[model samples]
Target: MSSTPANPPTALHEVWLIRHGETQWSLSGQHTGSTDIALTDHGRAQARALAPRLATQSFDAVWSSPMARAIETCELAGLGGQRVIVQDLHEWDYGIYEGRTTPEIRASVPGWSVWDSPVPKGESLLQIQARAEAVVARLLAASGRVAIFSHAHFLRALAGCWMGGAAALGAHLYLDTASISLLGFDHESRAIRRWNS
Candidate 1:
């Protein structure tokens, strides 16, 4: 009989990424960043719904964005006591573009994209990418499963970083409010186990 190793090289751990419940701005398709906002009634219900889904899972660590929406979601999901607020998990700072809709921004600057266009006095793509990478690093180091509650764009950037891609690639990942995504190793390779659930 062969002896089994204490720690298998193929051991897989999961990082659960959850976008905060819907806010008024989210429903209105507005750019929400830095400006703290509250969740709508439906959003609260959505957050409460997550409790059952997460009840059975055990997480080594739980983290949340400092923003009210995210913290509220984390609390409603029954992980508030376990959550450690991470400032870097906050959504991308949109600066002058904050609370504006994409169409509104386009009206002023044609063909402007949050991913492609620069936000005046706001965080750069590199800055967001760096923060995502830091979060990924911490998640990867966790001994067991970990959970994070954050914003849509921030979670998208985090997923991109977990897959070893540039933060700008997050534009391709469309995440809905109060959705769940899973990131884990697939036979030693980074993969998205689940998305926008």
Candidate 2:
């Protein structure tokens, strides 16, 4: 079988990885993935604040998940024209717990950590890594800074994958809604410039 390609060899181009803003589920600490939910009213405000923060930076490409929460974020952040929808950027598929929280899942399976426990029919760590790998491969074929609008877990996993870390390392990174992260190369290697703020 053909293996998935690694990230490109082009000089480190700035990558802006953004997590979408507040959603009812997000505020409640629920696992959000594959659920087409919209952002709260405040979420829109948070996304708009990004406009000024990004206005000065020129992005070669902008990609977002087809999910409303992510797509809306790009629109609110003033990146609609440059945005492209990529399925590989979609959030983790929560499966049985599509809209549930960790605490709730733990009730049945004590100490159930997503990193330690399976998502009960959702994407496995390696599966999610494959998705992340595809997106990185797409970026590698080009040479310019890119902005990715996506969700928490997926973006975190991408960061881990980008750094040659295991997919489970995604659990170590944290992200807030509308939060911007930087990823680029350091000298001769690809590295995460900064994790979630």
Give the winner by TM-score: 1
Each candidate: what lDDT? Answer: 0.86, 0.85
Off by over 4 Å in 2: 1-12
Per residue, candidate 2 scores C-alpha lDDT tens digits across 109-188 of 89987775787789888898888877777776756789999999999888877777466778888998999999877755
TM, every model: 0.93, 0.93
Candidate 1 vs. truth: CA RMSD? 4.5
Clash pairs detected, candidate 1: none
Per-model tally of clashing residue pairs? 0, 0
- Point out where model 1 deviates above 4 Å: 1-12
Q: For residues 3-36, what per-residue lDDT tens digits would candidate 1 score against the true structure?
A: 2223332443788999999999999999899889
Worst 10 residues of 2 by lDDT: 1-10
**Residue 107 lDDT in model 2?**
91
